[model samples]
Target: MKYRIGRVLISEGQLREKVKELGAQIREDYKGEKVIFVCVLKGAVIFFADLLREMGPEVDAQFDFLAISSYGASTVSSGIVKIQEDLSTDIHGENVIIVEDILDTGLSLSYISKLLRERAPKSLEICVLLDKEERRTQPVNVKYTGFKIPDEFVIGYGLDYAGHFRHLPSVHIAEPAE
Candidate 1:
């Protein structure tokens, strides 16, 4: 499948380097803490996998995947957050990291953050693969960010357009239908 709009925004190599850097930073900041890496599912699988490998200093922590939904199969966000599957681990007294593909609109991520906070995690922060600065309507502080993206539809490396283009090696815009 060919791209509809722009070319690759962030190539695979570029993504790798950024993730490595973020991992190193995280390792330094939370060296001795009990870090629980919680990756958001579907869109963040690839980013999480790469990032987890990049993190330095062995952490005696746990890893879990949270499947959440704020958007349907369309490009537009519905703004309603829902939990398809919840985390099995109790977040009590744990430093948790919520990893995601992109931070746009901020509703979903912010809601998730607050929800997790209620579980009594010792600390919680966000780490996103891509940050669409222009699309952020609400303020969200992500501890780790891989790239700052333009306000364009992107797909690849676990992000998709109607469930397609996720297999692309790099990020690409979905060509508009004429």
Candidate 2:
């Protein structure tokens, strides 16, 4: 099942600029403090790496990965959040940041935040690359947002349909090829 890329939703340049901005803001916000960036796995991997590089070398930062699945092969979430993988670190008394690819229904992220909060981190916040608020069923306090996109099945730039289109440099509206 091949898919076609339609209109460009987010350009690569825009992604780079936003990543740099988010990184700078986070660095300033946690200056002189050690921070742990907890990356939501698979989808958030690219954004997390770019965000970390954007933060530069000055900010004291560590990273860990946590994987949760709400959407399997479907475009819409299944509404069932499951922890596919858990973080190895304790995170107690540590400043924690949850880096996510997109905040759509917020079910998965909401679950993630609640689970992390239970660990008693010194601070916990969310940083997301995209926010599709039209379908939001749960509220998530996203501290850093790169873009507020309309409700569309977007692909590329770490967002994917099924397991494809994630390697593309820019985001695009996904469509079926005739």
Candidate 3:
């Protein structure tokens, strides 16, 4: 399969600034307490890395990675989520934040949230880099969103298609091959 960049939807500078802003907000929201940042792996790795860096020293942040898959080498979601990996540390009685790459159908987040809630976390919230509300089949309350984008197949900045385009610094719409 071949793909082209349709257009740059979010520039690197924009992502940087927004991440910093979100980090500041998170720090303020969870001040004087240790917060566990649960990064949804693979896609969210880039966003999670950059976001944590901007969080500064005041926020007592711990980190873990969870790998869940709803889309596998495809542009569309299968509407089913599978947990490929789970958190290493217990989140019980801790302020937990799930950091995701995108919130599309909300199926994955919904599943993850429900599963995590059962663990008795003191608090649980979601932070996504992108939200495609148009494609949402299930409702998800995102505490922090970097961008609200159209229902387009986006790739780059840790988003990918068939395991490609994850290295692009900016987010772009993936154009189908002619």
Top candidate when judged by TM-score against the true structure: 3
Which stretches in model 3 have alpha-carbon errors above 4 Å? none
**Looking at model 2, which ten-residue stretch has the lowest summed lDDT?**
52-61
7-58: candidate 1 lDDT, tens digit per residue: 8788888887888899888888888777888989889998888888866556
The TM-scores of all predictions, comma-separated, are 0.93, 0.97, 0.97
Residue pairs with backbone overlap in model 2: none
Candidates ranked, most accurate by lDDT first: 3, 2, 1
Global lDDT of each model? Answer: 0.84, 0.92, 0.93
Ranking by TM-score: 3, 2, 1
lDDT of 2 by residue, 1-178 (tens): 5578889989999999999999999989988888999999899999999999877677789999998888898888999999989999989999999999999999999999999999999999999999998889998999999999999989998888888899999999998879
The digit string of per-residue lDDT tens for model 3 on 1-178 reads 6787779999999999999999999999987788999999899999999999876778889999999888998789998899999999999999999999999999999999999999999999999999999999998989999999999999999999989999999999999889
* Residue 154 in model 1: lDDT: 88
Q: In model 1, which residue pairs have backbone atoms overlapping below 3 Å?
A: 4-174, 4-175, 5-175
